[model samples]
Target chain A: MNGVHDMGGMDGFGRIEPERDEPVFHAPWEGRVMAMMRAMGCVGGWNLDMFRNARESQPPSFYLTASYYKSWEKTLETLLLERGLVMEEEIVASRSFSGSTVAGQPLRAEDVSKALKRQSYERSTSAAALFKVGDGVRTRNIHLPTHTRLPRYARGRRGTIERVHGCHVFPDSSAVGAGDDPQWLYTVVFDGSELWGTDDDPSLKVSVEAFEPYLEAL
Target chain B: MTLRVRALETVLLEKGLIDPAVLDLIVEAYETRIGPRNGAKVVARAWLDPDFKRALLEDATAAVSSLGHVGEIGDHLIAVENLPTLHNMVVCTLCSCYPTDLLGLPPVWYKSAPYRSRVVRNARGVLAEFGVNLPPEMEIRVWDSTAETRFLVLPMRPAGTEGFDVDALASLVTRDSMIGTGLPKLPEVGP
Candidate 1:
């Protein structure tokens, strides 16, 4: 099984193979939905279960502000049409879902699903936290996610107490619906020799914050 | 302020699930409303008082709140003083935990993985990046702020500034100096 240190390989820091190119974006409506949820104190409150259930089961979900989504939906539809990723008829059909009926249109679920998946993947992989404050720990030398803050040169190194930043929500695989959970975070301070090996400058030190799960106390 | 969240918003938009404009409004609200301004006052106070400086090294949050800047984290804070013999630097290895009640918003570089990962591993090197070159004999104590405790650095008083009042001294204590990047220096007075 791959470990944290293996991330360098995916990003060409080591010998692991990289994944194929993938770009992701979100549907214009999702932002509005999340905002409205947040305004009701539903995003980070006890109502998480309610929201999650709603997200999974509800259709015609409430949007935060219709005006915000209106312009973005137009832009996204235009882009999809321009890229030939969606047919003119499909755009009209999607618009009709928002209650805007266009002339002579039909929709294909496959095309819309593919576009949504791509956008989701992009959002999920872009999260960067690998550590946090006050964690006594080390970095693993593996890669599995889309983006990481841990560097190739500092993997497997030891470090000490730093800060404990509050949970900022996990973006990595979670953004892509891979089940990565949000974690308490910390930053570890490592000595130069530990990260760079002997002959490295003795005076140097590096500090990086990773999630609680990313570290094992040393 | 909104830069980081906007980046998140962009990702959501790219996913074709969320609208960028809505994310923008949410981010704007967070940046302006829920932002941490209390931290700036403590940082400002640290620059001005000597006794407070002493108090800060002994206990950070209290010393800060004594000057009227309490934080949302840590019920009690432990301030690690940076002396000529021992130098202390703060970082949030897990995320971006900081003594925001004193320092205000963490600089962008502080939030970057490079600073967070590298600072603890090679503290001296990281300090150098901030233009702080520590002597070899001096022991560097890197404080990892996890859990409930928050930390701030009480830098040594600058030379050539003896007898300066608290307000005058505080002006010299810039955010960079407090972070250990630069030392407070006396501003040249007009002739």
Candidate 2:
């Protein structure tokens, strides 16, 4: 879905403001939320794509009200509830039901470190890359309702293959219900003139990692 | 932020969804450990050793892991060099996918709508807003981190720091420099 989170080109938000000596998190809860999100990953089913999709699924109004970590908190709640790990009333009442959640591994303190290191998507396979470095390719104009790694601005745009990042799990299929299907990943370079037109700085070049299915021979 | 998260915690604790001790551990890890300094060390090491830099650019996961800074978010990392001719920037247009293990959490601005929306289209303008006014002739390359390979911008070694040790060079790698929104500061000029 073309959610509001896909804010690549559309403007009017504000300037990119960087604070001097910015802290890792703003509030204490933000820290807890970050920890919870990481801990919740131990529950075992959802991938990063699903987590991202949930954050993006938020309605514009509520999404706007949330600071970056607030958005993470909201989605974490929704995902837990939907996964049957927590109940809506459980959250409301601030207590667990007798059989509130299904059997799952509780994230012990030690497991936190292990959990952080686990779940690597990088895999080795015998498949060879379809496109090599320096090959020119065009991004397929794919607009999917499901989660995707392809950004909107780069779709249908032409770019030169900068590097081939071996075969990695394809998120478009994996993010949904599909199994882990490895695809050739290429870092494609797009000229500033092509992406932004003549008015912007011509010296700028944008490069993005394009999946195999999202690209065609140019 | 404290009130809302505390309230949420109260609910979760009552509901038996979270363990307080475990929560504390996670907080400690993110707050005290696991952050940009790890990335800084990696960048600093690369500056000190060309072999490590080559290995990092070729396979960031192994090279970074050799330094003992690794995590799930950085299952695979692609360290892009910000050379004299090329200036690299990283962003996840689909979502805010960052190397949390290296940089801790992303700064607020990186996750903001303005930066996410405009960086892909107007990187020069966006960099300007971030106070990175690059020369027009210098090539700017924006790495849209739209895949599993997390990006870390290996900023160019600042000039006139020849005698500095790895620790001193490590101090120069800022959070923004790793993100490519800003450059590592030049060593302080002396009288």
Largest TM-score belongs to which candidate? 2
List runs of model 1 lying over 4 Å from the truth.
Answer: A1-42, A46-218, B1-55, B69-76, B146-148, B189-191
Candidate 2: segments with Cα more than 4 A from true spot? A124-127, B1-17, B68-73
lDDT of 2 by residue, A1-218 (tens): 67788777878988878788887677677788987787667663677777887888899877766788878888988788667777667666655565435356558877777766635776577887778888888898888988887777788888899888778888887777686788888889899777768888788788888888988879
Candidate 1, position B41, lDDT: 44
* Candidate 1 positional error at B191, Å: 4.1
Q: B-chain TM-score, every candidate?
A: 0.68, 0.91
> Per-candidate TM vs. native?
0.46, 0.93
| Candidate 1, residue A7: lDDT | 21
Docking class of 1: incorrect
* Worst ten in a row by lDDT for model 1 chain A: A114-123
